[model samples]
Target: MSGRAADRWAETRAPSLAEIEALADAAFAALPEEFRTLCAGVRIHVDDFPDEETLTEMGCESEFDLLGLFRGVGLAQSGEVVSGQMPNAVWLYRRPLLDYWAEHDETLGHLVTHVLVHEIGHHFGLSDDDMAGIEAAADDITPSEA
Candidate 1:
């Protein structure tokens, strides 16, 4: 490798939980306003990997098997907010995401955005096709529109 390439590689480190959370925020900000409005109260969390219980519940053979997850009631499953209810939440698995990113041809930011949107899709209880359409539409949003 070239001297500069090697130097750059040496300085690179995996993103921390806070950095991953920041990436998620930027990604959410980049989505269309309408969608953002719909995602008003969802919480996002970043962790190195899914917890042992989550892995077991999801039937994941390895921590790397899952990149992210969503928890809480979807719009389709909601009637009205109850006083004692927990808020909706999305969990981003950093180690798994980084592992996946290493094996794929995409920017980390782009991958984060993709995962965040998919989690939000779960919050809305959208079908795969419906989520795909929303993602396509999100891509179509221009700077001015955003």
Candidate 2:
């Protein structure tokens, strides 16, 4: 294929980072207020792929191995904020999410929300069952029909 055609093909196949971030934001907004309050101080970020340091820390052999990651103290363990301490953050890796989306029938927004909730759920010290229930409840209220 010609270079121009190849570039166009790549652009058409991949979701932009801005698109992913918007989806994540919408998904997060759909969550229950109780859950959102729990995630008040959390920051969500999106990247095309996981960095090398992240892969090593997560014990993954490849960047695509991790779709999302939660870093920082859980609500149950975090005491009063100490000086210079970093706040909690949840990272959503776009490349892995796109890979998963390509293989599954689910919408990208839903997938992003799911990963975001799962990670933030950890911050709240919620169990897997609790997170699942929260996800279901959130899905029921999602306005976009995605």
lDDT of each: 0.85, 0.85
What's the CA RMSD for each of the models?
3.4, 4.9
Give the clash total for candidate 1.
Answer: 0
> Candidate 2: lDDT over CA atoms?
0.85
Candidate 1 wrong stretches, greater than 4 Å: 137-146
What C-alpha lDDT, on a 0 to 100 scale, does residue 121 get in candidate 1? 92
* Candidate number achieving the greatest TM-score relative to the actual structure: 1
Tell me the deviation in Å of residue 64 in model 1: 1.1
Q: Report the lDDT tens digits of candidate 1 across residue range 2-94.
A: 999899889989889999999888788878788889988889999999999999999999999999999888887873567888888899999
Pairs of residues at least 3 apart in sequence or in different chains that clash in candidate 1 = none
Q: Could you tell me which residue pairs clash in candidate 2? A: none
Q: Alpha carbon lDDT of residue 69, candidate 1?
A: 96
